[model samples]
Target: MNETIETLLNHRSIRKFTDKKLTDEQIHTIIKAAQQASTSSYMMAYTIIGITDPDKKAALAEVSGHPHVTQNGHLLIFCADLKRPVAQATSEQYEATRANLENSEHFLVAAIDAALAAQNAAIAAESMGLGMCYLGSIRNNLARTDEILELPKHVIPLFGMAIGTPDHQPELKPRLPISAVYAENEYPAYEEDVAAFDQELADYYESRSTNNRKDTWSEQMIRRFAKPMRMDVTELVQKKGFNKR
Candidate 1:
């Protein structure tokens, strides 16, 4: 396989990082790659906040419910930002209607933009032989995250990414067969395929180096779905001045 495809296929989340830190040039290159990602209608509705201060990182780690947040790496928070555009419009004496500002479409667009940019950065870091982990746990306390980051209205902290040199090597996790993911004219039957893949996942989990547990993907998913998760997200989005529609 080509280098790019190989990098993409060998991707694994890195939890432990070495003492080595990334240089300013490396961080700049990664952010540049992220900025090159395509945005919805070129709105570029995203902002990246890099955290380097130890105290701030520790606070964010506590708020995110992930101790790895304060690990030896560069930590960045990706925010879905509509406030930038609104501020620009206001500067130009352009008034945005309530529908234009608070519609689901705008919220979705900003979220998509932020996700795309973060993925681009992740791929770029991986390509450069750097270890990285995406931290969705940062949203565990969205209100606190906003307050800590001093986020203005119309900006939502989507996720965080930690990047550094690898201190641990993990086995590649198995994925479902193509039969379960790919379909032609109609949606192919996935029940049997999923059942088969569950066995493979259970074996992997039991054999993994860290946090080995006897469980299948389906079992974990069932436990996850047993209760509503992050239900406050709707209200949080509304508080950010979007999703009102």
Candidate 2:
């Protein structure tokens, strides 16, 4: 396999990181790579907030409930931003543009843009031999996170990333089989495939090097979605001037 394919296949979410920090050059390179990611209609509607202060990082860590937020060599918060475009609009166009920006479609675009850029950043960090973990728990309390970051309207902090040198190597987690994920003409039923994957994932959870647990992928999904999760997201997103349409 090619080096790039190998890198993609060997991906693992690294949680534990060494004290060795990323150099300024490395940080710049990673952000540049992220900026190069494809954007919808040339609208690079996102902003990256690099947290360097100890107090800010600590506050973010509290919001995420993950100590790694403070312990990582570097922390980056990726935000979906529409405020920049809105700011540049002409006085005549401002009202119409603001109305368009409030649409749910634009919000989705910003979110997708942020996610694409984040994946690019992740690949860049891994290719440079650095370990990184995505901090989705930052969204667990978006209101507090927004307050901590001092974000303005039309900008929302979607997620955070913690990057650094590897302090621990984790086993690669198994994914659902391709048959269950891919289809040619139309979406196909994959009950059998899912059942098989459940067993595979259960085995993986039971045999991993650390934090072994007797659980299946299906169970994990159920546990995650069976109840209303982050129920405050709708209200908070609206507060940020998004999804109003």
Q: Which candidate has the top score in TM-score? A: 2
Local distance difference test values of all predictions, in order: 0.88, 0.92
TM-score of each: 0.94, 0.97
Tens-digit lDDT track of model 2 for 1-245? 99988888999988889888899999999999999999998889999999999999999999889889998889999999998866877878888887778998999999999999999999999999998999999998999999999999999999999999988888887887888999899996789999999999888888888789999889999998999889998899998999998
**Candidate no. 1 TM-score:** 0.94
Cα RMSD (angstroms) for every candidate in the order listed: 1.7, 1.0
Considering every candidate listed, which one attains the maximal lDDT? 2
Those runs of model 1 whose alpha carbons end farther than 4 Å from true positions after fitting are: 91-97
Candidate 1 lDDT by residue in tens digits, 1-245: 89999999999999889878889999999999999999998889999999998888988999777766887569989999987876756544544455766899998999999999999999999999998999988888888788889888889899999999989888887989899999999998999999989998988888888889899889889999998877877888899888899
Clashes per model (N, Cα, C within 3 A): 0, 0
